[model samples]
Target chain A: MKDSKKQYIRGEINKTGQSSSVGLIIRQKEPNNLETPFDQVDSFLTPMELFYIRSHFPTPKLELASYQLHVDGAVRNPLSLSYNELRDMPSETRVATLECAGNSRVFLIPQAEGAQWELGAVGNAEWTGVPLGALLERAGIEEHACEVVFEGADRGTPKELPIPPGPISYARSLPRDKAMQQEVLIAYQMNGHDLPQDHGYPVRAIVPGHYGMASVKWLTRIYTVREPFRGYWQTSDYGYWDYLDGKPVRRALAEMKLKSEIARPRVYETLAPNQAHTVFGAAWAGETEVTEVAVSIDGGQTWAQAEFLDPIQRHAWRRWKFDWLTPKKPGQYILLARAKDANGNVQPDQHDQNYGSYVINHPLPIEVFVDDLGRPGR
Target chain B: MKDSKKQYIRGEINKTGQSSSVGLIIRQKEPNNLETPFDQVDSFLTPMELFYIRSHFPTPKLELASYQLHVDGAVRNPLSLSYNELRDMPSETRVATLECAGNSRVFLIPQAEGAQWELGAVGNAEWTGVPLGALLERAGIEEHACEVVFEGADRGTPKELPIPPGPISYARSLPRDKAMQQEVLIAYQMNGHDLPQDHGYPVRAIVPGHYGMASVKWLTRIYTVREPFRGYWQTSDYGYWDYLDGKPVRRALAEMKLKSEIARPRVYETLAPNQAHTVFGAAWAGETEVTEVAVSIDGGQTWAQAEFLDPIQRHAWRRWKFDWLTPKKPGQYILLARAKDANGNVQPDQHDQNYGSYVINHPLPIEVFVDDLGRPGR
Candidate 1:
């Protein structure tokens, strides 16, 4: 990013106070990373300003008049469509939750390097755009094409990356089958408004059910690669690294695992004894629907079913609530919540992931104090 | 704080997204604690929303129509003023910096108990209200008065407080001389706007050059006590516990120490070699003026004087900038900033203060990567 560009963005940020009303906390400034507070995620559609931002490079300056998305490689016809031209095509809108692959890296007991995110690096938004399948169908993919690669306009040589020194476009690839799924969208709108700059203005890829890395922002190109695209994002970063039987196992992060988070009764929150308190939280799953959520207020010794809120949308999170009556005794209590998805995946009791802290869906222990006379209300 | 009151406040916070634009990150939610990101303190007068909040209890809900501030004790004429009545009096505005005593507790090696604040737990703002000196003069303080105690409306039994379990109002006291300073204000306005709810809406005490704990929020009572006030905030919580001359010395926290913080070129920020980058930051002092600010690029071995910006306000922070020309050889560089005050006080290179992490003015080391063939426009 240029100093001049940074100054411009800073001026805009100062003038408009972007995301000031979204309750999202900034993690990094240059690449412009932000995360939402878990408790602030009370609605099914995450506010645009509260949406978590994960940028590999500074937001690119693009003019809608000149912005062109090129679709080429292993295709019968290479097409370069302008912003308006692309928007004029058949469009579909879907509610999907996008989560960073390293969402809960900070929660890892041993800690991990990267953005020290808690549980705020995920948000559900209504995305409107043309389907990637429609675009690929228009381009006529070749019979041997095995991967679809998306490249964002934002480009920079990541500082400390061991790769050879050269500017690289932020890119990620998806298998042919996933790329053809109708749920994958070339999004130009978020929620109900035009996509914000930090969220990929003009156009971006919205891969429902997959980690945000697969949903390339500030998108500029779509390539039909005959073989699996070996981009740095896919080969070096985002991929999970762990050991099984003393053998190294590497898996590229894709679908988000079943996860549940206690939004209410924040850590160290004092609760009034014998009072009924409503425990609110959110639960999500990748591809599959959340079937049930359980709450355990006594260090997970026993579990009770929680009521799921109405209008549970596909590819989006489901809100759950439980009426918890405080124990007659006043002391410290560890609260835990877990979700079970239709795919038979249950939130794990502990996180043992080693590589980059990816897919850590371990139920976090929320410590709350039960004080009979701590404070009025609850 | 009652649960209903908390829910009401949460509803308001959700409706307005109170801290959304301020870039202040939430540290704890129940007592409503927030800290500003170091880089977000760009201007001399921090936007009201960006000001760091340190509430020991939930913000008290008070209606301006019925709000009353009682001034009694060692005063010739006890005064009780309503919100409107208080505003009707002569008002003065002063730019002052308010810093939590534990602004950089997170950086304390070996760690410390309490909110792990980074550099963001401080902000400079313009406070508008009648000076405490003016108010005290109107009340005609008794000659025997030795201390002035300010008590806030917010009250609750602090969870895990070492003291006996009971509800306690948040209170602090000032020496007779400090209490009569013209800079001490019973502020009702912040940054040209009525104070926000979290910022002590109707009225709050503003003690310039003193730590934030002295500026009691949601102020409700003021007493001209004949002897020193022995409140938990003053004697037990905020006091420093450290060994001096082989004996324990417990000193009450008062004015802030000389401090400087780098606001730009965040940690691990990659810079392009051979590029001129301007490093921006702010420096502040307590009861003294910052004389100079120094920047070091090579691990503090060599130092260079940074240029101070214009319009340095009294009792507020001074913005400083350093033009750094990156070395041709690229690797990693540690940047450091320190401030010296007129009272012969210099920011220490290391933090050794143990209790409550008060007045920690140690120069923080910022690591930045310099890539030779990195992207242009640093």
Candidate 2:
């Protein structure tokens, strides 16, 4: 939570980049801009408070006593549940990493632009909750129905969506199939403690896969429609780029891209001659397993195999490591890492910058310092 | 977002005594409590804001000015980025729905267990951002690296994880291969506006189909490690019971199940004489696509074909409808809808609840209204 607690996991930059009120290079005062020092070299995981915060608005505080979740409409029984009541119901849990679509936007060349997050906009966590499908069955549904609509507590008109014939707000729909999947959870706890106020306290829905928007926060209502939800969020925003048309196209929901990242050795570290350094990073898939990972030094000239620490959690990130023999003569060394999932998705050297930000797969790089003795330096 | 805008969809109770939130429900704050109203008439997509909301905690209002996303540890460049800079980089967008592992958890019984969300938990929206892989590439990874860690603004030390030795934060990791796919996104906008303050505004990551926790909101930092994340969220909280060992094996990430729901006739509605009624709903899958949808008015005794409406998106939801001839009797009529996707995954009649509150799929039902003359009541 403080710069002092921020461990220097990765090495230090010889010179600072730009300055902002929100980051290490830039001194920021908001939680969104809070940065942890990288000196602490713990094993693989990053602590929670030290984790980066990516928020759209300010953290909201709600009186637990006044909060309630309501279920009604096409259901035979209408009910209102308190946080305690929700917790009392059957509990379930899941481990996942939520990454912003623009976390790595800084690398895009020609600056086809949008959010400039270099790579500090993502985190992984465990969510605990009750399955949403269970509550619907309790409500007792009627026949002759079609679509399920999700609503959130956030209020604002998105600029990207077309104004609907009716008053527009944020909303999206799921087909009956997805609506019934139990993975959909009304989560109440993060890790093991109560949900954080900043994360959506009292309760939030954990929708696996898809983009973050579909996982509406501060959830308030549920709508069942025979027609598709045509809210501004659906028709106008987050659609897709028509690569062929060189314009936007109507596409399916976005899923996690095959991805990999280095987890240690903050850049610009000096290595002494004949020293051995260990490299670390993570990889993941939307719903599939991470089958393999490869690492390359010398600007990706050649590659070697990396080891995945845990292969049991298929959808979860797999830790990998490769031992780098210190360079005999150190000048400037560029370290590169890339990975592939079981699905045959290969990372791209670089992504095409489009107006509507989407689909990026570029190799990650790191710089290592090897002293004349060829050993890692202090 | 007002209570008047929310809606809930539903269908008839099934053999498992389960129902689904298939239609639109409205949210209205009344003197009594949060008023959630369901529409029993025409099946149509629910409007945004009017859509349902499901969350695990109070919505966080992130201030972009103070938000800082940090990329450190195990890279050539350990940098921090601000919201404004993120907007200047290349951007991407996609239409996707994030469904909770427990979205339809109501289907679970022994008496409805866990987070009691009745269908408003999931939402569809257009997500925009840069791929996390792109940023990692710019950071320059080193060899002997294993994993990348993601952290959020929310803080809590819950169940202890097995990865790191100390009390770690909520975090998860990805192996190298899966981390570099095109699907992974560092999102800055949702439904086309700066992300709503409640959602991970300034930034968040979208990981397609795995689970919501994987898509960390209010993202703040990225860490590289040799082992996968072992925070409470990953090891103890989100892990599932697989029934693999003599006891249930803990499954790490929640996977979606094949499911369906009906979103038409309001329960307890009266049917008029000689009036035609329409049956509607939508469908989805983890890796497969919903290819077929079927409807039944006689409670599984008989079934008829339904029509599918595709608006161009693939994974979002495919609207489906069926027209039924007016019934000749005045007795209660039951309606049901089911789907089959491109991968041939069919909606199941009943899905058993898993231990970790993961993806569940169950058949959907609808109760039609009938009058003395055998017609549907409006």
Candidate 3:
């Protein structure tokens, strides 16, 4: 099968507002960002080339032979281990889904200031890595440490902002509790293959249930700080507006919101009337498994249950399909898929502005025309 | 040629929050709210039966011969004119679009509170009536009059609100300037025919460029008030959160926002790949005409111009078509249509939450699958 001249949208700047890229591609260089061609998606694991790449800066050129993982800061014993030493340590594999914090920003009207990504900025994959908590166990984190910061090798200045404030590498911090979770991994392989250049190369962080940004790629350093980490990405970007204690603040985005998208019956697809069609799509919620998936054929006036197509997993997306009998009279109709998680958190019907452009898990309406003379589906 | 089980969604109570009416239809009986079956839409004008209907109260029982439009309040000449008297005065016709401010509330995430209308709550039609300014001129408004309120005969107690504020009639207010516009109508005839009962029967106000709410149906009383109208529909409902003079206030909604929708390729309609297809849709901007429309086949990566199908008319929706060569390799493809109006107001890629659930003009995503075996379209 031929690849559909696939697209991998790699963001080149930190300051380029999403509205700026509405109809323009800002750059054409490397540090690849790709969207999994949703139409070609017939399986659970995303193809490597199709896995979306969201880079804060250019892909760092790393030499695995000389690379060392530095563990320092608020640790009882600061240690730096070579790549082989880390790879030789205990490892485990799991299937997980990672979505960019701003995955579906395109749906955020008025266009928030960030990477304008569509629904393709997410994927489920099998990752092999050593759990970060084991490393923290080896290093013996200090009791006073409250934040764990991950710093990557890539570094650059964000040129789009009114005041360029970078000259710093891409870095982020996790709360001590989140870092200590056994599910967080310092991944060295994706889908049984060594990490590709654009992805972290030799080693990368795989923080499941969190947006892709939390899984800091191109890893170089890990630091535990006594105070909360106020890194640029953590404080200024990747956060949502929140009112805490009656005061407005930027709350750092953590877990992914429950989301579902109708991947089949691609947009603008013409369909034949009066026949049974297999309508398929995918749905995922961060840590909470999606308990129910439903399909709406009449613009949400009604919804029916969709059968799960794959085995239920804790952190991976569930593939679902609905067998629908097309209305005999041909005309325009709307198809929408909605998902409800185990926590009773169902996909919202409207955009919650509090989420800004991130956590865009709204079940967007999919409009398609049914023509009596149209072709039959596969 | 069948009506396709035509749907007209009318609301019985004013207190029903949108989010509350999610999957279930609140009441079956009607003042009759109907949606124009968009698939049967072939011409520029929306057929009368297909036109959407919205009602806050049951249609008032009005006899045409006894109908009198009482123009009183801050006017120097308080006068009452019967239906025949107004019809004999003068008449004008206009092709205008009136969208329910809550037309596409289904697209609003978190499911706003009210009727969950899809895209059919809007339509363009030739409304025939006398200019409201002509009547206001004859009535001679007093200098102190700052607001003009129109009240319909429909009245009932709202059943859903916690504090039940009614046993009130359906009414709304327009600023004096809006009321004085020659384009504003006290319409008696629709599409060269008498007004339908579901619509404002004997007479209705056609406030061009404003939402349907301002076009009060069953015009029974017209009042030019010295103070702003603080009615239920004006202050407590149908208003957006606005910060004015450094204070948070509910700003009265006026004027329609720029909006475009891909009416064809109804959601989930499957189509064959590698072919030339005519992509079609409609766009409208209240008061202002749509200047240009574009289509994006690559998830908004690029946009191409689309040709307008009908003669351009202000205050009416413009039909547009694009000759698209479907991608050869059949996979899923997204087709997004966007419009820019004469005032440079373009369709937004994200939903602006500030507008709340009222002005939901965000470009919604329509997902479709391109299958190699799908049949052809008409």
Candidate 4:
């Protein structure tokens, strides 16, 4: 590639066999000499290192011999699977995304509650594992069961709780139908390798179209229940709290709202006078497929439809690219990108109330410049 | 302290004399303890562990004997001070607060162009050192000097350029008055100890009210410039960009705005019905003192005055507290905290256009809960 200033640098194969365009957010912690290969991001797949790795406790070292997937409670035939057994099951592969409910939370002005995950908290993974439905069938879930709970192997540093027990590191769950979706999987591999420790190795459930919290990492136990599960990761924490009357009230978990992020034309890249280039980005939804992506060179006043890469399903992200011609004038410009889902839901400037660091279809803006090249008196 | 189910239970103090708060935002690399024995925080005085360490290049392991502060550039006396010589100067101490231009950046929703920092970029400390103005006086500043340039010990990694010749670490300048402020110290001591390795052990400047970038850590050189210093840290980066007709225009650096952070009442803390407690937090601004803090229980309807601790000075944060009585009704309530600086600049619900992240003064929403006590009839 020529080193001269160019319009855009698309992800291309490099000498090391890794994509050239994959940028590293933090160079400090990269592995010594190992380069992690990633599939074409194409707007959906988040590089594992870049993918949000949310851990209750620090990533634990586990041995496959001791790792077990236990199934009990409300199941006609309780079943347990060793790591190998689960890996041997007829594997199902699906391209889906897992986003933290608190993704892009730093953008939450007026500072809301929770972890300050700068923007990289969502990722697309091609998960290959046993179908959740098949696993439930083998376990013989009781006809009366209403919910299935997935637990992780992590044990958090405990804080105090009421008399008997305290804040434990665990997550629970919902309706049998929701748990049995074909998109849901009990996986041991992420992308193509054994899960990185930071990302639950051994095994974890990849529940497509939901928050990462729903996809319990370091999978350990699965339980069938007739009533709602109120574990710490569910009820008392992670849940939304409304600050009404000077206090917080817990709100039920809702499907994540739509969101998008621009990967190219990074914040302060200088452009030659009146230069034109194509801008690229990715957008995703919890369940709905992104149908269109709109790019606005003038903030949000006017927007032109950008090209959207077709999704493999309703759960994957759609990559979009907009061709931007050089501005006629030399000044600052805000590029706004907004994505609309198939349901006709256009991204909003901000989300409605229940927006506790959760969903927002707000259009993202990227500012660029057009210099006065002052070409020999034009 | 009685172990009550009502208030949060902070962890037991460790032998190191550090107390662990339930929700202190700490990096995995940092100690879990979160106690502040010192009341004031300097702009550049990040704790040895929490100090805002900016590394443009790789961190160098410098031997104490090899490190020296070089003072040259348009001066009658080009002097170099060994670490010991610097320590011998009349050491002055001040509490200053340094915020990155991008502090509270997550607030710039609709995703602004640039790095995403969720408020982790700000820190305070008690810095002790010789004044830069005094040092310049000893070195004899030239009459034509317009800007003072300071450089760090780091050599930035290679990337594309106009990028300014790097090994470029941190650098910044100030108008005459700021540079001459008696409080503007070339700090060598942090909290009564030799500056740690991560915090420019032998020396670094403590420029109150300026962004962290200006207080170059591992500082090594100080130069006077007749024109503005053309360095990457100064321009072509860090500057704000405006999207003018879809193009980016650079914005200038200015004073920071008033902003605050909730120290307690974390995101999903559950409240036992009818529990009374105090909501505590800290507020800061540049060039002004924090005068008053207000609490809003009903979103923004009515506001109540919060008790402000003793006022620090122009560039220090003033801790504030608000007592919230238990609500008669059981539900969710949003606790909003806003502060007004002595300049009468109150925290805004939303801020103006952000090119690169700049001062953020958005109101912080603390989600508190007033749980419903089960009724006897039920």
Candidate 5:
């Protein structure tokens, strides 16, 4: 790679990743943001073909032979490593879930703008990559470094906003402490395969314990900033109200909020009356793992504990299932899934909309109907 | 106020109101926003000179001879009233406390934007006026009216904002129900005198139980709006987070928050050790009158009930006092006041800054020190 400024090109939208086999729900057509059918998620490791895809811009066309990840800015040693070089570095694979901040935006009353997504904009997968700390260590980080900013090759002027931003390379910055963590990865593979172009090609950031927006795709540059990054995306978009020194202010989006989704018995799905049924779902949290998944079968008036099918991992969502004997009477019933984190941060009945159109992690009311002719698990 | 737009002249600020007798603290100079020194508030009626002044623009200059109040918009009968005609209408006198939403903003950590007032941007004044409801009734308000907008003659392009709006009149709206309330006033007088230039001379709206902003000064136009008013003053400037159908959104600033201010033993005041001092203050709340005021002589660790000096009055602040004996060995002491409303809404230790520099109704910590040489009354 040459000068990033000179080589920067705002690529075109990817039209090839919408594979019919995955049956992924397309939240957006251009830039290719596809969601998995969360109800169909049957395993701990979300199949690569069925995993959710979120992109801020068009997929950049980069050749592996010439691809290089540049590590500079506030560093004693600035180095550029090729795709093979990154792959040859100390590698680790771990299962982590990535959920879009705006996952349940469709549930917001008065409807907020931007990606009206429901559930399925989340998935857990085994990401194979080199710890970002190793690359930063080799680059010899500076003491004054405060932020590790990641800039991707995908650059485009976002045309959706009233005042479009300048040509932006989908980027995000991590605090120096988070960047130094061994779990923070410069991922080269997804589910034991080379990074897919539909995702980030060659390499991308896999930020565990954070929202997917923090995981910059189509990686091209890693820079240590002496001060906090104030990019438009960091300040304007993908930010929420955070208190600093007891004053409410806009803060860059980070940690994914605790959430639980009822994968089975989907919203408005029909079920047979007086039949045995299984209610299954996935729960996830940031920083702390979700410790409890309670399924409420009566519009949150009463709750029944759900048993975890998948073993708990550091950053993976736990799959929980609840066995239910459908009521004999035919009527409308509301189902809700609520997750509690290790810190006792229970999913609130309502989320503070200060998060704007993002972090819509409130307990969703999924109204399902019971009818005599309806199938139990259709 | 004939042909308000044509007669609209954004008057220059009055420089003569900085009377030293009142000792009012000037928060802003050009547009004349003065805050009362709450510690000196010795009575329930905040003296005209001591009362706070909040203005978005310069003091509008108007001639009573030519003044005309226009009642239009969503009304069956649009009428204009002359100054004498409005004064001839059934006159009423009501004592109501008006408070700036940004009062006590200086206490906010990391600080917030707008006026950095340290309490005392409030005052209970005896308002002499005609009920705005009477004027609206004569105008025959349409059934579809959702809001009653009050527009003051004060008009200017607010220079402080990054995007200065086009020449705009200071305007705010009340819900249809609140507008028709007899307590809502159209005043041409203040404290037994013709309204002073600094305090909206010819006529103004005295929206009892609401913040001062809703009481539009220099009021020139009264209009019934079919939809909720989305003017910049109602939307951009004075707004707080409110939940509608369970979604947090920007809501126009309305009712003043419950508050208690220590009039005596003010912030950082020095007191003599082993001496008895009267801890006196005032407490006020909107819609609901303050039922109880608690004084904490040693910060908030312990509290003692305060006795009301003035009889409780609707829409008026209640003056409260507590007898406190200075600790014998006191080197430093923290004084705090907490008020609980009739609705049981107690003053919180911390206010939600989501109110955004407004509704700063937090229990303020007033640090006072005891010195052996300091005079007891000092």
Candidate 6:
């Protein structure tokens, strides 16, 4: 990238301030990687500013007036449509949570060689756009098609290895079954406004209940393949490698694991003594419903159920709260919380270590102090 | 406020999107009260949008081109300065944390009769403007004045207030000594940008290390008084009533109490088993410096010291981190953190309940879950 072009792209990224006001932790400047902080998850609809940004390369400078989406391969008819043509199609909206496969990679016992994200690399938003299934139906899928691949406009050389030696466009493939799910979207709007450049200007893909890698940003091409697509994002980068039966095994990443996170009383927060406080957080699952959440104020010695907030929707996280009364005694205390989903998957107490630290789900322990003073004073 | 006026003010508030993208929890629309979610404190410099907004009335629409700030009372020469004139004066910038006196009111056991805010009502930011001391020095102080009063442009009838039964402008007073402090600023910029409307467009006061009520927003008037100002906001609203020696005593709110809060591993976060996770949060004190911060992962049974991040500025928060190693055996656990300032003010274990829930500094407890599966599965 030339100095002038780089500076121009940097200017365009700065223009995002006009649309959203949520603080984002910028992980990389070139690829424009940003993550949302956990506390900003108080609202059901993640504000556009707080939505996490993940890109393989710098944002593509595309003129909205001339943007086009090409759909082809393994079909009776291939279709190429302009940005307006796709917008004119029948549209649907869904509130879904999109989490990076490495959302909590920083928590890995042995640090991983990827974005060291904590709890901010995930967000829930009301996505509005035409369903990818509708586009696929219009293109008429061939019986031999086994997978669908989505490619983005941004292209660059990935830092990690064992892939193509040169520049490659960011791409990922989904199985035919997952591709045809009604919730899969060719999203044009996030929250309510047109998608921001960081999110994928003009258009992007929204794969509900799946990790963000499947939802390619700066979307430009869609094609079907006869065999399962073997892209780097699908096979090498996002997959989990672990020992099974004393042998190493690699599995492709897909639906997010059942998980829950505390959005308030962040780590090391101090609470008031003898005061009634509400403990709240959010719980989510991949294709399953989070049924119950529990809280432990006495270091997991005792457990109490939490109440869920209204307007619980599928593919979206459920916010839960518990009213807590602090003991009269002043002392340090540890608080713990866990969630159980409809699939009978309960949040575990610990996760086995992994090199990549993908899909970490362990009970997080938070410590807070209760001051001895009951009233405010100098 | 009239319906059309209300609509216009709302439009101005929406325009804040241009200056900041931090998610703000809007408490009420008419009075324009907003709070910052605690997790957004990932960085030391709080973004403009995440800065808490507290107005007793609707935002008064003022044209920037015609705006003027008046300085009078207890001065040798009264002066009226335009925005550009103030900008041209010698200026300084300071990083300060401004917290509402009633930030954690919602956590009050008896349920305070005000906006229910959890840990999101506080934020830190770099403010740029002329120091109040410099401006006051230019005007010269009069001996009779004991208090300096700051009045804002917003005006309305406050709900459920005992005093001044009709419409009144929001105002507060500061002691002469505090007013003369070099750190007190007549601020015009937040985080290096022009102040957003919700955050006192054109100019406001920046009282370093003081509760937000002292740093009045949308400031229009500055004057000194012979006696302490007895406005509703000064005496009735932001005060505490506690029994001293079995006698009722009332104390007005002032500097923020020594406090600390967790920024990561939010309330109900899940952890990975057998992994190393960094436990991090932020801590701040009143006029004193935070000397030490401790973490308790086993319900306070064991305490460890956390490392502080660089550039720990006064009147601002210090970010701290701890490397936590999850036990190979996973089930459930509680986490806790506490802080002690240079003045020997250690975070108390509990606080006595107060009506307004002001200055709550109890340690916050966060609960997290750990999954049984040590590795990711297909």
Supply DockQ values for each candidate.
0.01, 0.01, 0.01, 0.01, 0.02, 0.00
Candidate 3, A1-378: lDDT as tens digits: 123122222222111223122221222234455565454455577756667788878888899889999888889888798899999999999889999878777767788666667667888888898898888878989999888888889887643211113277777788899899878999998877888787898889998898898989989888888855544464345655454222133456888889888876767776778777778778889989998999998899999999988767888999888888888777888899999999888898988765656788888777887886645443
Model 3 chain B: ten consecutive residues of lowest lDDT: B11-20
Q: Whose DockQ is higher: candidate 1's or candidate 2's? A: 2
* Model 4 chain B poorest 10 in a row by lDDT: B5-14
lDDT (Cα atoms) of all candidates against the true structure = 0.79, 0.57, 0.75, 0.64, 0.79, 0.75
Q: Please, what are the lDDT tens digits per residue for candidate 4 over residues B2-95?
A: 2221222222211123333323233223212122222122222344454444445555567789878888777889889888888788878998
lDDT per residue as tens, model 4, A318-349: 77777778686878888878877779997888
Docking class of 6: incorrect
- How much is A4 displaced in model 3, in angstroms? 18
Off by over 4 Å in 4: A1-44, A158-167, A241-249, A372-378, B1-378
User: What TM-score does the A-chain of candidate 5 achieve?
Assistant: 0.92
Where model 1 places Cα greater than 4 Å from the true spot, the runs are A1-22, A159-161, A242-247, B1-378
Q: Taking the tens digit of each residue's C-alpha lDDT, what string does model 2 give over B150-194?
A: 766654433222222233333555555556666667898765556
**What tens-digit string does per-residue lDDT give for candidate 6 at A111-214?**
76778887888888888999998999899989999888888888877654223335678888889998999899999988777898889888999998998888
Report the lDDT tens digits of candidate 3 across residue range B1-378.
123222223222112223122232232246556665453455577756667788888888899879899998889998899988998988899878889898778877789777777777788878999998888889998999888888899887654211122267777889998788878889987766788887899999998788888899999988888756645464335655443222123356888888877776766767678767777778888878899999988778899999988777878888888888877777777788889988787988777665667788877666777777746632
Q: Which regions in candidate 6 have their CA more than 4 angstroms from the true location? A: A1-22, A242-247, A373-378, B1-378
Q: Estimate each model's TM-score.
A: 0.47, 0.44, 0.47, 0.45, 0.52, 0.47
Q: What is the lDDT of candidate 3?
A: 0.75
Q: In candidate 5, which residue pairs clash?
A: A101-A359
Q: What is the lDDT of residue A298 in candidate 1?
A: 96
What lDDT is obtained when candidate 2 is compared to the true structure?
Answer: 0.57
Question: Tens-digit lDDT track for model 5 on B1-378?
Answer: 223212222112111234234477989997999998877666556667667999988888999899999999899999898999899999899999999888889998878778889878989888899998898889999999988888889988754221222466777889999988879889977777677788999899999899889999888888887756655565446755453222233457898888998877777878888777788788888998899999887778998999988887999999888878888885888889999998898997787855767888888888998887745343
Indicate the docking level reached by candidate 2.
incorrect
How well is each residue in B135-220 modelled by candidate 1, as lDDT tens digits? 88889999999888888999886542223234667788899999998899999988777888999978999999999999999999
Interface Cα RMSD in Å, per prediction: 27.3, 20.9, 17.9, 26.2, 16.6, 35.0
